[model samples]
Target: MKIERTQTGVRMEKRLLKVLKALAEHQDRTLGDLLEGIVLHAFEGRAAFGDETLQVIRQLKAVYGLELTARDSHRLEEAGDDR
Candidate 1:
């Protein structure tokens, strides 16, 4: 099936972006491709990465110092927020 794609300007946490980029490189896919797969899986309520891929993601997260977890979603504060 053919799907239409669009360019988006989305903001994300710095360390998380580094981990994602590294993971995409490790998997030999473009960052946007990787993101699309992840989002599609999430929409289906399925796990995106299997054990081996998850292990690689863990290593990437460690290397990039991504401390945020699912629990932190939607609760992040900007770096210079005075509130």
Candidate 2:
């Protein structure tokens, strides 16, 4: 099925967006396409990706300097006030 998509702006961490863009290019897909797939899978109570994709994600995570651990799941304040 073809779904129409609308362009929208969203605020996100700069490095995170960089990683997502790289991942999209690595997978030969668009950022919107990848995010839609991930979100839809989550809504269905399923893993968004399999082992292979996870590996690719890990590589991208490392390249993007994202050293997130299982215990890092929590809200983090900005490093410093930009203003």
Candidate 3:
């Protein structure tokens, strides 16, 4: 089966976007495919991926430079800044 896709323009939080792209690469999938699967799973009230995927995401985050820890994110938000 083949699916047709249209390119769409969108804006998002930079860090979030970076993480998503990294995750896509980590899973050996295209960004669009990964996002589609995630959105569709969410629509069905299911988890997008499992613990194994999360472990890969953690490793890929470092590889792709998406290393913003939760604490770091909180500190940035508290300071009203982006890093």
Highest lDDT against the true fold, candidate: 1
Answer with 2 or 3, whichever has the higher lDDT: 2
Candidate 2 global TM-score: 0.81
For residues 1-83, could you state the per-residue lDDT of candidate 1 as single tens digits?
99898999999899999999999999999999999999999999999999999999999988988889999997999999988
Model 3 root mean square deviation, Cα atoms: 4.8
How far in Å is the alpha carbon of 29 misplaced in model 2? 0.4
Off by over 4 Å in 1: none
Candidate 2 positional error at 27, Å: 0.9
Report how far off residue 43 is in candidate 1 (Å): 0.6
For residues 1-83, write the lDDT of model 3, one tens digit per residue.
79899998886557668878878876798989999999999899999989999887777677656767757754544345555
lDDT of each: 0.94, 0.83, 0.78
Model 1 CA RMSD to the hidden true structure, in angstroms: 1.0
Using TM-score as the measure, which candidate wins? Answer: 1
User: Candidate 1, TM-score vs. the true structure?
Assistant: 0.93
Q: What is the C-alpha RMSD of each candidate to the true structure, in Å?
A: 1.0, 2.5, 4.8
Candidate 3: where are CA atoms >4 Å away?
A: 58-83
Q: Between candidates 2 and 3, which one is better according to TM-score?
A: 2
Cα-based TM-score, every candidate:
0.93, 0.81, 0.66
